[model samples]
Target chain A: MRYEVDWSILARPELAALLIDGVRYTMIVAAVSTGVSLVLGTALAIARVSGSGWLRWPAELWVNLARHIPGVFWVLFFYFAFPELLPATWGSALNGWTSFALAAGIVALSVDNATYVSDIVRTGALAIPRGEWEAARCCGLSPWQQWTCCLIPVTLRTVTPPLANRTIHNFKNSSLCMVIAVPELTWATQQIESLTFRGIEATLVATLFYVTVALALGVWARRLERGGYRHWRGAGAVWRRERGELARVDSRR
Target chain B: MVELISVTKRFGERTVLADVSLAVQSGEVAIVCGPSGSGKSTLLRTLNRLETIDAGDIRIDGQSLYRSGLDLRELRAKVGLVFQQCHLFSHLSALANVTMPLVKVKRLGRGEARAQALALFRQFGLERRADAFPDELSGGERQRVAIVRSLALRPKVMLLDEPTSALDWCLRAEVVANVRALASRGIAQLIVTHDLDFACAAGDRFFLLQEGRLREVDNYTLACCAPEALRGLSSVPRGRLQAVAA
Candidate 1:
């Protein structure tokens, strides 16, 4: 069978706009989900290692559940079964909402990625010597101070490669959202194929989008690992500000 | 003053510290000698409440650590403990590593902390290495920074667990000099080490910990068993301030 590739479908303004919207939404979901997962996943990681069983058990259960289930199953479950679990008013409202699919995709992807992110965080935390934690404690740093300055930085530095891998995995996982009619890049490709019978051209554009973004993030993550990028501008005085605040309270003349 | 009255600690079925009682007075270098696993480390940790005692009480400057309403962070600030491995926060520079506790625990302004830290760094001759990270430093340098971190808080008592284990003999004299400087300032020192040579250098009130039991031991007896006494070894490099040590 001879394959005929048609590029005419993307030439029209409206069709082009649809693909652009798909790209935009896909990036938004990836970015927002990554941010949410980073914070929540790290918290879960700390809970998993906490001395109290009350904290550890719940975090462990979450990681285990997410790990055992496939990614597509989670997306579909969120899109289908999750709303029914909510209160009737919210459930029905969400079901009827125009952007419900995208919302569901973000929630599903964030948590699914969070489980893996937590594991990465846990391993990174464990990799640090216990002596470092003890050193901070003996110096009289509060639990919050220790986590922010010492623990978080070590975890971020040590697990940079794995974190980057996980993030790219998350971006790829956004494709799963298409199953719920979220109209992400992959869904847009399928729509263009159905309408114009030009599946190859649409699929090519979608693939390029995924590859470029994923590659760029991977590069950025590597740079982050090597200390090639500093996230906070004007963060130099942040610690000094903490000291200044302390001085005001304690009357350091 | 620091006092441990009938302090006992157990891990599962094993008693690591048993009814161990001791005191360290201001400006005194109280050394505890023990073989590996004799609970010397645990004794130091107990003073700072890093290792919870299964029985008895610890009093730092006349206040019972066991009593409620005690600000643990403030208490810890008054009693600084350094680990055997130096354990410098690897992510931070040497200067930041020392200043973090000052900012977080001591609540000192950056100006005050920086001034104090820089002064100590100069006193200890570590000013050149302030910006270096832990991995960038030698073992002696790392331990010195750890000491600086503890000193920045101006603790009433400083406890060190096997501090000299990480340093070469040449560095040991330097460390001993630093400890002497700290002692001169009237900060009580409780050092735990099995190295008789190192212990003797600071053993003003030398003691021994054996099988969880602790008792005062004499300096001459400890010097008899030093490695140099056995094999005539003097690892302390020549021209390494032997006169100052004398």
Candidate 2:
């Protein structure tokens, strides 16, 4: 009846393997989904702000649907309902696949994450005055060059924090894949809890895993938010490093 | 030469420009001066098609600018337009801002572009400020950076919208001098501002835009541009006329 916590269960080598595998899958899922979302989200942002209606409308529909619906619903939809919605041959092909759950999880997470990412990018991109675009154009940059070279770099300056936040959210959301029997960290924790009846230890490890990853991401995002990464040869740039080293050597001598 | 033939623009039901025709000859300094909301900026913007006309034909050197075959980026590069505010890329250093067009569009070597931009920055007296971001530079430095960036492409025509509005006396003189020097070197320029003194001083041909129409800026043109109520005072005595204007 007293409060006694046990950490001895995780001392086993098998338990260590299980936890490591869990961490591996969790990281893999987060990394894959984040890369896919960032690329897709940037395209969507460009479409939403584009002058053409063809590009704008479909992107608007996807963003509106993604933002309005809950992320969990998307996760569940991809896992449970998406293959059914596919044509029979494709659905059967998916059902026979070994990594169906992971693939579905990636699609679901990327789509859900992409919408918020697009929103962040669009807001940041739109915040730039129209004069900037005119200026770029006046300087003879093509539309493709304009967006890629100037607009996107500046947009990232404003969107980095929010983009990083959403990615971490997506990373945490990977735990939800456990609901579909994916062997992620949360799933491994549940298995240990049921098998060894020492859920406290497993739960603590899982909690620590998520906390450390999220903190690292937060710090990296802060670095990006400080900006000037795109600006060439800013104050204290690489060229000065040689001079600085020389000054140090002279003073030391 | 850059020519606007009956360039008309409207936003919703409000007509911003109506049958506005103007020309900027090579090496000419054409100034457009009018009160705010009189379409002075819009008129200058039309030279580079920054503001598209609902009905009009714009041509540069006898080539149709608004037509489908004309390349927009080329046309834009041909006629440079600098905004009233600095409009420098906040994320770019002054050197990078100047070099971007050279590297990206012109496909110049990075070293060459950097050299060109550094030279322009040096010429503009921004020697120590090349690596500075837009926020680090003062309003005048930013404006100079923007001008240098536009000039990197060697545009045949340059457009400046209220370049001196956000500047102090020293900065204004620098900007006006640079703009004048560009015109002297055979780049056609269209400058739009509300400052009559600047327009009179720099304009080879000054214009007064009123209620969507454009006209030459002369004494008769000024009297014609005045509202009907004010025109009645022109018949008054000289002192009374001055009082009325005041």
Candidate 3:
């Protein structure tokens, strides 16, 4: 059976607007979930390596439980099961909320993505040399200061590649929201295809967006690993100021 | 400025430091020489409370280290430690490595921290390499930067663990000179190393650690053990020892 390709259906103003809105929602879900997960995952990783049984065990359990469950399950659970589990009034309110599905997708993706991020960050934290900690301590930094100024920076730097990979995965996983009718890119594509019989074109556009974003994420990760963002202009200013100070000191000597 | 009072530390069934007592006065440089596993490193770590003692007490500038009210971070800052591997924050530039504690711990402004760190770099002849990362610096430069980072806090006492482990003979001499310069600035030093040449050249007092016990030793004993010490060997044959001594 030969089928004719018709790109004209997508030319309709309403259809184009729907697709644009879908992209916007998809980006919102992906960006918000990635940011929340990164911060939460870093905290979880710290708790896991904090050496206290109380903190470590709970974090371990959470990460393990999240990892064991499928991403789709989390999406459905947050959208369908989670509201049902709440109190009667709250459940009804949440179910009736217009943006409930969007909230569920963001929450579900963050929860799922955070576990993988925690594992990556934990490995990076553990891999840091003992000397780095001792160095921070010797300079009089408190435990919290050490992690913030020394340990965390180094660990995040080391885990950038893996963290980027997980972020890209989470971005792609936003498509899972279609199951709950969250109106993300994939859901919009499905809608457009059913209405206009242009599933191939819509799917192609969605796929291109995902591939482009993922590839861009890869580039960003590589740049970060190379320390490309460090500005030498600040260092140069410091250098010039110090040189003047040194000249004055040398004259005194 | 630093005192260890009969400090003892043990790991499982093994005793690393046993009743080790040592005192280092301000402006003095003390050397601790020992073979591998002789508790030298553990003894140094105990001063900074990197490794807690099972018994005994440590005092820095007349304040008890393990007392209930003592601030561990303040004590660590007051007692600077230089690691064998230099351990400069691999992600930070040499200047940032020195300025971090100044800005974060000492509460100095960013510009103030930069000036202070740069002054140390200039003093240590490392001003040119301030923007370089740890991996970009040479072995001696990294060690110097590590020393500078510790010195930036104006520590009362400095603990160096095998500072010469990665340096060649020329760099070892540079370290000896740097130690003397530091002493002149009234900062006491306690160094743990097997390099007799470095110890004899840099040390004002000498101690030996063996079998978990620490005792003051003279330069002659260190000279006598030079052959075995240089090799880091536990034992040297009598005939070879005599030949080397002769």
Please report the candidate that would top TM-score against the real structure: 3
Pick the lDDT winner. Answer: 3
Best by DockQ: 3
Q: Residue pairs in steric clash, candidate 3?
A: none
Which residues of candidate 3, in runs, are more than 4 Å off?
A227-253, B225-244
Query: Residue by residue across A114-171, what tens digits does model 1's lDDT show?
Result: 9999999999999989888887788888887888878888778889899999999998
True contacts kept of 1: 0.64
CA lDDT of every candidate: 0.82, 0.80, 0.87
Q: Which 10 successive residues of model 3 chain A have the least lDDT summed?
A: A228-237
Clashes of each: 0, 0, 0
Docking class of 2: acceptable
TM-score of each: 0.88, 0.87, 0.92
Fnat per predicted structure, each in turn: 0.64, 0.67, 0.71
Local accuracy of candidate 3 as per-residue lDDT tens digits, B139-172 = 9999999999899998999999999988998998
Error of 2 at B122 (Å): 1.4
